[model samples]
Target: MPASDALEGIQACVFDAYGTLFDVHSAIGKHQHRLGGRADQISLLWRTKQLEYTWIRSLMGLHADFWKVTQDALDFALDRHGINDPELRADLMEAYLKLDCYPEVPEVLSMLKDGGFRLAILSNGTPAMLEAAVKNSNIEQFIEKNFSVEEVGIFKPDFRVYQIAVDGLGIRPEQIVFLSSNAWDAHGAAAFGFKVTWVNRFGQSKERLPGKPHFTIANLLELPNLLG
Candidate 1:
């Protein structure tokens, strides 16, 4: 009954790292020189399958941490996208660890932190991976914590992962505003009782999901404004 009410009393803004705070495509594109003409296709397919595997695996009750799933997805995408070099996979993954933040992210997050709202990351990434990405993107300063689901041995859409974030941070689920780039995860968080904000960077049309976001924005640039 008081669903969007989650947003009204938000105490902290927690984000999904890969697509929400970091630029996934830019990370892939950085491998363009090595990936040659297939860079874009390779990057997109890998991310696509990476997410697909997580969804299917969650549904099938098989669990893999995010890093393994990222590689498996990369393997699948490489084969389908005509890439065959083992060295290239390493290069691409190295780039993933170094993804740049969306240009607007740093400023908006700074505003949020300066305003005394808590800022944090709750990701499916390994702790090291999450840390590396955040450091590379220059987002570490604004965040108070970096939380990984790996500690709890699960990926998202499982509800338990969100609970880990809530419990680990010692915050009520309703006090945290969960920001995600993936519509499905946004749906999952909202259904699980966190405030949900969908960063619809790619202009995705809303599809039916169990629960919907309290607010949607084109980028983090608009986030601070929306929060107020």
Candidate 2:
């Protein structure tokens, strides 16, 4: 795709993690394959529990951190699936550390950077997770920086989580284009005054939020064209 069209007034494109750039779901799916008949069922439980625990911990101010939340979630999922295999759980977590990259990611990020747009990460992932993902996924070269919410000790949809990018960039809110695969993150960034882009990969309907994205695209492949 050509960069002939992109979002107007967009100097930088900041991304949300866990889904936006990494194929996070693939981690569960691939590992669950070893579980045979219960693959999808168990995988779904793991992913759902992972997110649920994160939110619950965040709300309760328990703050176990994303890594701990991940492990705890997997434990709950394994119990639900009636699997007590430690090796299987280990395999699943390993897959997460080595998550697959979306095909369009490298090219799009390279093109965006070549097209002269600043690229950065704004994620709920821990500093280590974000760094590891960026390095292992081979998308690091294209990213200008990785911002983590560990500094704030909270989860996203909270205005503070989005600020990791703003404060990291040392730029005004209007100077950035906030992009996320998650609508909630998009909403939070938009509310914070960054021009938002909702990367609607699944074609999901937008949640009712006062902070709507400035652009919506099916995937990153369509983004360069859409932004223009």
Candidate 3:
């Protein structure tokens, strides 16, 4: 889709961090010896459990920051795959803080900034994690703010998490463009009444959820055109 009036009235852009702008698997790819042939499954499980923990914790009213949830999920994945090494765990955690950003992120973010839209990262990541990842990826110059679930001590697909953007940006929900690689996140944002763009990087099917995105694109590069 090309840029059009469909993006009219958008004053801010809020993005999900993990699996969206950053390659969540890049951290595991750096540790081939530890993961070996199970790298893919282990990576998938780590992410799956990470998200599951967030939702479960939210529902149980027992909240932990995303960093802790991430570590817990990583531990589960490591144990499930029969890989046990304290040093490996440490390395993986550190790698996560500096996850490799997608090649198109920097340019796309710059383009958005140049287009005069306010930009922020609203993520399930903690403030420290988001700060480190943004700085490490050299996108700090483009983003205007970072919003973390830590502020409310909850994970996402929750209305409260998405509320941070509307509240923080001082803009109406209809005026913000929320983007995510995860379909659930897109659905959540759409339900919250924000215009949403699902960056369907993996060619996943549309979710059968309450809210649907306004647009679906293959990557961040397509975002600029969609916003035009």
lDDT per model, in order? 0.85, 0.81, 0.92
Q: How does model 1 score by TM-score?
A: 0.93
Q: Report the C-alpha displacement of residue 11, candidate 3, in angstroms.
A: 1.1
In terms of TM-score, the best-performing candidate is: 3
Superposition-based RMSD of candidate 3 using all C-alpha atoms, in angstroms: 1.4
Compared with the true structure, what per-residue lDDT tens digits does model 2 show for residues 1-228? Answer: 233333456678898877789877787777655888887777677777877886788889888778888888889988986889988888888777777778899999998999888899887788888888888888888999988878899887778877777778887788788888888778878887888888889889879987878778788897776566
TM-score of each: 0.93, 0.92, 0.97
Q: All predictions: root-mean-square deviation over Cα? A: 2.1, 2.8, 1.4
| Per-residue lDDT over 1-228 for candidate 3, one digit per residue giving the tens place of the 0 to 100 score | 334666788899899999899999999988867667898899999999999998899999999999999999999999998878899999999999999999999999999999998999999998999999999999999999999988788889889989998899898999999999999999999999999999999999889999989999999998887787
Pairs in steric clash, model 1 = none
- Best lDDT goes to which candidate? 3
The per-prediction tally of clashing pairs is: 0, 4, 3
lDDT of 1 at 227: 69
Where does model 2 exceed 4 Å of error?
1-6
Query: Residue 111 in model 1: shift from native, Å?
Result: 0.4
Candidate 2 lDDT trough over 10 residues, lowest sum: 1-10
Question: What digit string (tens of lDDT, one per residue) describes model 1 on residues 173-220?
Answer: 989989999998899999999988899999999969898888888888
- Estimate the TM-score for candidate 2: 0.92
Off by over 4 Å in 1: 1-6
